[model samples]
Target: MVRADARENRARILEVARQALAEDGGTSMNQIAQRAGVGPGTLYRNYPTREALVLAVYQLDLDRLIDAVPAYLESHPPVEALRGWTTELVDAMRRKHGLGDALSPGLHQSITERSYGPVIGAITRLLDAGKAAGAIRPDADPRDFLQLTGALWRAAALPEDRSQPMLDLILDGLTAGTGRRTP
Candidate 1:
């Protein structure tokens, strides 16, 4: 069992690295360790490689996003909850894409592969809620929704950031024939 101090150190390091990498993807490990108030050895012991750190940060973000499904569903209507969730998801995706240079191609592929199932499960839960509430079409599929969300973050990378309106269109399509389109 990990001690409390070690857990705190790891959490602090991940938090610091998440913020630093958001501001500057090329930030060095020494810089992160300094900002995190941990020694270089501590940082290296926690994350043996820069790529490992980057992957952990991405995984942390995805885990939060996935865990948020239940809370979002409880707090908002299905379609609106989905909107809020998708917005955060797009932002996380953009950050991960920004850090693409920090990850090796193989590690990138591995992370995506490992993350896909959970992400789809999150989408499935959201879609299932909407379907049960009669807010989404019966034909809606989590895989297709995820595919379209890929376009969202990609379009978001462009100067225009048209992802919101694009998402509105997508969500509208999902709610079509269900009589749940917002007035």
Candidate 2:
């Protein structure tokens, strides 16, 4: 088990690394350690390598997103919850792409395996809720929704303003005949 101080240092390191990665998409262990206010030795003891550190950061981000589904559902109507979550998911995909080129192939594979299921489940829940609430077409498939989102994220070339229109299109397609008009 990790001691309290070690856990704190690890959290601090991840926090610093996440910001550095967001700002530049490239950062060194020494830079992370300095920014975290932890010594190099402490950072190494926690992460051992850049890939490990990055993987940890990615996992933490995914966990927060996956875990927020329930709260989003409780706090917003089903369609609104799905809309907000999709926006967040798109941002996460952007960050993931920013870091993807830097991770080792093995780490990338591990990330895929670790991250896909929770994301799929969260999205499926939102889709299910939307359908049950009559905010989405009864036949709207979660797998199809996933595919559509994947395509959008992969496009990467779409202008920011245009992407929302595309998202609105998808939402409209999914909600047609269900009485949920795009807002």
Candidate 3:
């Protein structure tokens, strides 16, 4: 069984690593250990390698996002909830991309492979809620939404952050009554 202190240490390390990496992806393991208030031995014990730690940090972020769906749905209307959630997802994707050359190709592949299914499931939940609320089109597919939004995060490096406005348009298209009409 993982002891309470061991779990706390691991959580603290993850939190510190997440912040440190976001601020600067080049942050070192020793630096993360120091910042986390844990010894290098403790840090290594929890995450045997820098790559493992980074992967853990990323997975934790993704899990946090997935876990947030219920709260977002409870707090906002369907469309608004989807908007807020997708906005955050875009930001997360931007940050993941921001890791850029720091992440090895294998790491990139690993992250993408691990993230896709859960992300789609989360989108499915959000879409289901919107459908249940009668706000989104019955024909809307989560995969299509995911494919479209893929471009939003890819555009993050642009001088102008035009994602939100573009997202607004996408949401409008997804709105129940807005499907194309007969000519």
Candidate 4:
């Protein structure tokens, strides 16, 4: 077990790393250490590499996304809950693009698959609820919806400005036509 001070230092390092990565695309270890008021060695001791730090930041964001789901569902209609979650996901993807740009593609893929499971599960529950309530088509597969949303993020990450219109189009498709599930 880590000492209380060590745990505190680790938490502070992660927080500073996340802030730095968000504000500056390619966050340097020295910069993160400076922001956390820690020495470079301390940052390295806590997180051995830049990829580790990036993965930690992604996991932190994923935790927030997972925790928000139940609250969103309780407070909003099924369709509204799904929409709110999608919006949050888009914002997360924007942040992810910044962080992943600095890391290896393999590392990014591994981290995303590991950290995104809970997020996907939350979305699945929301989609299932929406379909059951007849707010969404019963034939709508949650996985397909998620894949489409991810595609939107990828499109938004493009050099061009396609996010808004693409998101609008996706939202329209999600709610297109009647709620009837074709036999």
Model number with the top lDDT: 1
Every candidate's lDDT: 0.91, 0.82, 0.88, 0.80
> Quick one: RMSD of model 4?
2.8
Off by over 4 Å in 4: 1-4, 154-165, 177-183
Rank candidates by lDDT, best first. 1, 3, 2, 4
Taking all chains together, the TM-score of candidate 4 against the true structure is 0.83
Ranking by TM-score: 1, 3, 2, 4
Query: For every model shown, what is its TM-score relative to the native structure?
Result: 0.93, 0.88, 0.91, 0.83
Q: For residues 1-183, could you state the per-residue lDDT of candidate 2 as single tens digits?
A: 889998899888988888888777667889889999999999998899888898998988998899899999999998889888887787777777777555778987888889878888999999899988888888787777777776566554465545566788899888789643468
Note the residue pairs that clash in candidate 4.
Answer: none
State the weakest 10-residue window (summed lDDT) of model 2. Answer: 154-163
**Model 2, runs deviating above 4 Å:** 154-159, 178-183
Q: Which candidate is the best by TM-score?
A: 1
The better candidate by TM-score, 1 or 3, is: 1
* Cα lDDT of model 4 by residue, 1-183, tens digit: 889999999889988888888888676899999989999999998789888888888888888888998898999998888888888887787788877456689887887788666777887888788877777766666677777777777776789957667767766666676565458
